[model samples]
Target: MADELKLLSTWFSPFGSRVKLALHLKGLSYEYVEEEDLMNKSQLLLESNPVHKKVPVLFHRGKALCESMVIVDYIEEAFADAGPPLLPSDPYERAVARFWVAFIETKLVEPWFKMLDGTRARAEMADGVKQMLAAVATLEGALAQCAKGRPFFGGDGVGYVDVALGGLLVWVRASEVLLGGVKFIDAARTPLLAAWADRLAALDAAKAALPDFGRVIKHAMMRRGAAAAALAQSN
Candidate 1:
């Protein structure tokens, strides 16, 4: 425990998934502690991330690291020589990747999560889905430019932006079924993203890191139900 790295996570969270992806890509071995229930917070979690009290808290060498992206960032820097570099060597390219990562969070991630948490009304939720698709369309363009005929956003191999968004692939796929087959990463509209999703999914790190599709869908459905009930009561 003193010398080893530990990750506190829930099985179905994309935030946790991304951190796991980064760790796996780096070939890092970590102890994963599954938090079965968020409502009943674990002592380790509370101590690890008191400010956010959220999952995806990573403990390295007896110290705690909070937030998923922050943890990913830390993993990349701390374990730079452990595996392939997630960010590019050039500062400009790294900046570009970081920008896209920000876009993924503000545009795609926020909207998708708003719908997931049932924080919005029915009409608002529909609008949220629209926002998500719009972000996907934007990322489609970003991918074409960034990839330059390569297979990934980072080119050839998985890069920072790829790990950032790739973590959400399972949820994105689940959202299609949740939306009655509405395609967020449409082959027709966002062909790059559609293909990117497939390639990223096929990666060994992705397979090891990502939550199971069926289980994610089931867990999300239950969360949606709870959120809907709460929203209905509030309304």
Candidate 2:
């Protein structure tokens, strides 16, 4: 086989999972190549995504696509017939879905990556958690508006926003444990989002694409522990 479609990814990368979700949802088959060491980059990955030098470089028909969301967009456009649509058919609704995807990237995703960063002080990390939680509350409201009381942000089915946020579900679950039981999406506070998580998780696509929670948590623990040690040394 010429390997028409190939995915270069790390096991626990939510970004990688996003690409996986799109592939799985579209029911597209591809070769999965795990990047063993990020520090030691593969020539293929390096050539594919020289700008970022990151995992989740998707090669389709010998053409390389970099970035997670970009890959999803590609899948949605290129393989529209492969499965159900993720973006909305209505232009306005499509715009709305894209808007939420951006929000998740900035408001939720940024702070998440910020929290427990080894270079930053613990206090700064605490601030990150606060910001992350605030984003969650905002997303709770967003889900109501976007999903229109439906189970997913995509309403009747898993759409753009669902994949955007759902990609991070495993990370969010791992983070909850890593952060000493802080509930980002609380049933009491953000009932819709809390329920949405459970519902999205139950889907076949999620089960297929989402990384193993235990593996992610184990990796996250190492990072958190290192960050904590760095903070202690700086104190």
Candidate 3:
């Protein structure tokens, strides 16, 4: 089974890394395929995820699953017999984990993209800053609720919720620099989120899945510059 799994991913994608970590945690040996060219996507990735045409597609026994969290959930279901169990059996617990994942994807990541687009347009920049601050505050509140005296989302052990949130930390922080100095997850301000990040980073699987923060930040800055140049050219 180890030789059969294949992962299609990009190095800097938080979404892609989440799927990678889940497969690793399940002790599944997969062929890692990095797709660096987004403009010229791989034929396999296109056919596998025609709707999204994105990275982090998982192929297990020739069946393809798209989307990071969905693929991770699929991996958990298929490889339930191996490694630490990521999702909770309890229905309520599973719901809660899914809720947080949704929150992060919608409220957290979406606003950052807005903040990125805000760079060239004065109106967008103003709105983006406002939205980003509000988004960060909401995350701080959610973190406070989840912290309930435990290190992870599952109280003691790392679970699906933790993995979902934890996977985005490296990319989020790297993106802050590109958003022109918006520090959303500051250790000094959002202490609980900061602590959670530290705890997650200490885990072996987290460290293995993460790319160097410095390189991610540099790549983000370059992406921002390219976007800005394109916008200018259009104007």
Candidate 4:
């Protein structure tokens, strides 16, 4: 029987983009339902992910899966026979990939968003940015160990870790622009990660899954302005 798949997503969400990239990499066909307003979520989304009420909810044959990375893992297992493997075949290697994916999703993402939102004071924001960069540097070291001579963290092709981080690279670039040309990932500081970001952005799956860079920058600029206004009012 053919799989009946539906994805609840938002275009600007990096989490949603992770699921999209995973689906693309697995060559899976799924109906995409965009949640236009996250605040006023659809009944489908609320029912699908009642706990989190978040985007990137995947419905497979009427069973809904919440959380972006969890959905990606489910897609990999469900469509294991269809396309290139998103995870390594070896058990140890697969565990390593899973670890890094978790690390990226949990450790790096929050600080990056905080930095982008400008919610912290200047000193605290600087510290948060430093912590975020330190996390990226750690991942850069991991990439160096795992990538060998290959272009991606998964060695030759995009893998679980790549999907986890690649989706956010667009926002990182946009945030950099919004921060007055501050370069977060550069050759001088995080060369491996900087280069990996470029490679990931150029992938066909990434190109298809990622939203328009211009739109991302415009949205980020508006957020930056709003954040600045809020900060000023608070002072």
- My TM-score estimates for the predictions, one after another, are 0.93, 0.92, 0.88, 0.90
Q: Which window of ten consecutive residues has the lowest lDDT sum in model 3?
A: 226-235
Candidate-wise lDDT, in order: 0.83, 0.82, 0.73, 0.78
Model 1 vs. true fold: TM: 0.93
- In candidate 2, clashing pairs total 0
Q: In model 4, what lDDT does residue 131 have?
A: 76
Q: Estimate, for each residue in 1-235, the C-alpha lDDT of model 1 and write its tens digit.
A: 3139898887777878899999999888899999766777789878878887887888898889987788888998988788889999999999999999999989988787666555468887888888998898899999999999999998988889998899888978897898788889877988889889999999999999999998877776777766333221210
Error of 4 at 84 (Å): 0.7
- Candidate 2, residue 73: CA error in Å? 0.5
Stretches off by above 4 angstroms in model 3 are 118-120, 225-235
Worst 10 residues of 1 by lDDT: 226-235
- Which scores better on lDDT, 1 or 2? 1
Please, what are the lDDT tens digits per residue for candidate 2 over residues 27-46?
88889988776656789877
lDDT accuracy of residue 39 in candidate 3: 64
Provide the lDDT at 37 for model 3: 73
Off by over 4 Å in 2: 1-3, 223-235
lDDT tens digits, residue span 125-191, model 4:
7766787878888898899987997999999989889888887778777767776776778888889
